[model samples]
Target: MPGSGANKTHAVVEGGSIFIQKLNSSLWAEANEKKILLGQLISMYSELLKTIFKNKRSKHVKDIIAALEVYKTHYSDGMKKAEELLQLAKLPMNDAKIELKAIMELRTVLLEMNKEEVRRKRRSRAQNPRGRPNLSG
Candidate 1:
């Protein structure tokens, strides 16, 4: 969210702006739907993690968390890296001096989000059966 999306916009412009380029209407629609599905999956995973922690159900949390991690790496991270590569390739970066201002800002945001995620998880589970500090309270 820090990049102002200007770079992506610029990259889109420079890269022939494929956002509107028709790649078989049906296929495009399918891809868009899949992206939305991935978003929903992320949300569902988050909710599941919250519920598992709230209920103190540790039996299968690791498996679900592992699946979520793989999903992000395979689906989300791959898309992001591809987008960055596409943007860099489209722009005429002289002598490989590509300005990754956008990606760096994005990385910062992701790191912050990761930290917040850990905090949230910890806070959600702070109230254990054993006498521990209850973040919720």
Candidate 2:
């Protein structure tokens, strides 16, 4: 909860923003769904990590943690980086020169994340041809 306060402030600011163009209801709904999914994933991952740590001495637990680390890097980091880049892109451009450079750098980071995520998914599927196990049940 280290950043909870900042998130609340950001939510307030973002919620109060004025839009020149009318918002698309479908896209907004999709975004909300995605946010909910991301939050659930983060919460589940955190709990899993805590449980894994309790059995860190086991080789299998260590392996699971390693895999989770890869998932964190490829998925969580990528999503957060993309979200940040989007926010930066939305800002009004006062200094085009500086803003362009920052945007380009963020774009490169986002592209790299996408490539890594694709590679990870391909490797995962290759390792388990039957696909990921059902966790919902």
Candidate 3:
């Protein structure tokens, strides 16, 4: 969760490729730290799955489980990709093109996660505006 807030902020920004490139540069500058943060996210998502499963009879339980499973898969893949990037970073003579490609791939994963977060926020807000729905109908 190290860059969680920043990721949200980037997702909210409306601009072109330059803005995205800036975000990518920031991410690459702290790639190792981001990798650790991704690992922590994976663990947190796994724990969330376990907690949801404990409530077996909740409404829309199947939907919730499915969504969480997808999120977990995304985080797991992100962690693996980040690890690969870290290893590539440690090589004696890394190819700049290859490193750039890897960094872009990792950035893609983070962007997708950011999109999901935004979608979830919108859905929640639509479901419960002002924290409650009108009872008089």
Which one is best on lDDT? 3
- All models, RMSD in angstroms: 22.7, 15.0, 18.0
Residue pairs with clashing backbones, model 2: none
Q: lDDT for model 3, on a 0 to 1 scale?
A: 0.67
Model 3 lDDT tens row, 41-76: 656655776675786646676666666567656567
- Give lDDT tens digits, candidate 1, residues 19-130: 3354333543656455644644564676678775875657588677767777766577545654675786788645344446555578888999999999877866764646
Write down the lDDT that model 2 would get.
0.65
Best by TM-score: 1
| CA deviation > 4 Å runs, candidate 1 | 1-28, 51-55, 77-137
Q: What is the C-alpha lDDT of each candidate?
A: 0.64, 0.65, 0.67
After TM-score superposition, what is the CA distance of residue 19 in candidate 1 from its true location, in Å?
A: 25
TM-score to true structure, per model: 0.29, 0.27, 0.27
| lDDT value, residue 93 of candidate 1 | 46
